[model samples]
Target: MIRILFTMIAIGALTSAQAQTIESGSHSTTGYIKSDGTIENSSHSTVGYIKNDGTIENRSHSTIGYIKSNGTIENSSHSTVGYVKSDGTVENSSHSTIGYIKNDGTVENSSHSTIGYARGVKKEWAAVVYFFFKF
Candidate 1:
């Protein structure tokens, strides 16, 4: 009986640990960019933000990178990661295109795959943007 109880406790501890790890993973935010360059989530939460100088911040308000006026996006370490074009198409640092956000609010990939959409508007337009990850 003691052995069975110990096993159960071990299982419970493992399950709890796994849950914590999953909860700490990257979180998705559905938000709009304010005219002042702040990113707010649907719940009105400030998931991230943009600065006048084009610096971007994460939910924790940590400086993640910058977005230049020319639409070039760079990381905090100053590495080119992607670009946001005038036509609404987003491209990687290598200039390889991934998707575009249409005027009607549709986000489509190179293959024309609809990934997501944006709604509403502000003095500064908001877009359904994606971040490029480098392995």
Candidate 2:
């Protein structure tokens, strides 16, 4: 009975996960960022995932990258790829300012041109999905 209860709790947790909509700058639905770490397209196809320990996995579950607790981004080989600053500034490995994820969910390029939005999504996750990878 204890085991069954635990299983039910786990299932409940997974089922309770929420998904935040991702949108283009024009506000058209583009994709989603699920609370359980699933990244899905607007059509509801799984595109990628962000694991609890910051490991990023493709749809096939292959390790692709990571987002460290300190906001450091890394590639599959564990090489530093970029960073997401607390203020929403995004920088490349060379520390060049590459983009920004605003508090309002607006995503902007180095030139400050609006590219997209991921409202209600974590900034680090938004940076990885929007700037580091195409998914």
Candidate 3:
């Protein structure tokens, strides 16, 4: 079951930029993931960024973490923090399932409860920003 779940995450290279809305489970607008990788609050204030190279940065441009090409997530110190698997299974450093990013962009907790949504956004980005709160 774990293997099957891990296989479901859609890992891939960063594609062309397209702005996407981020919403809470209740469907309230939370923020926006912009074409240029800027993360903004509903008020349109810059909050963070997700670079094309998978580098996560704060509003101040400090390195926060990384979502690697092969689905490995690393902290600024370059330590393995967690992973957003190819199948959308989000696991901690210990490799235990914590959440999931569904194909339709629905974010779910380990119990499979809907926690948020990131429609039209890349699963890895959605997982990091919405699920992991990396930025």
In candidate 1, what are the lDDT values of residues 1-135, reduced to their tens digit? 999999999998775433100000123335455555566655665667777887777877788887777777888998988777888877777888877767765666777776655533311233223444210
Residue 48 alpha-carbon offset, candidate 3, angstroms:
0.8
Clashes of each: 0, 0, 5
TM-scores for the candidates: 0.64, 0.87, 0.83
Q: How well is each residue in 1-135 modelled by candidate 3, as lDDT tens digits?
A: 887666554332234444688999999998889887889888888999989999999999999888899888888888988888888899988999989998999999999999899887888788778656644
* Number of clashes found in candidate 1: 0
Candidate 3 ranges beyond 4 A from true positions? 1-18
Tens digits of per-residue lDDT for model 2, 1-135? 999999999998876776899999899999999898899999999999999999999999999999999999999999999999999999999999999999999999999999999988899999998889878
Per-residue lDDT, model 3, residue 106, is: 93
RMSD of each: 13.9, 4.1, 12.0
In model 2, the runs with Cα more than 4 Å from the true position are: 1-15
Q: What are the lDDT scores of the predictions, listed in order? A: 0.59, 0.94, 0.84
The number of the candidate with the highest lDDT is: 2
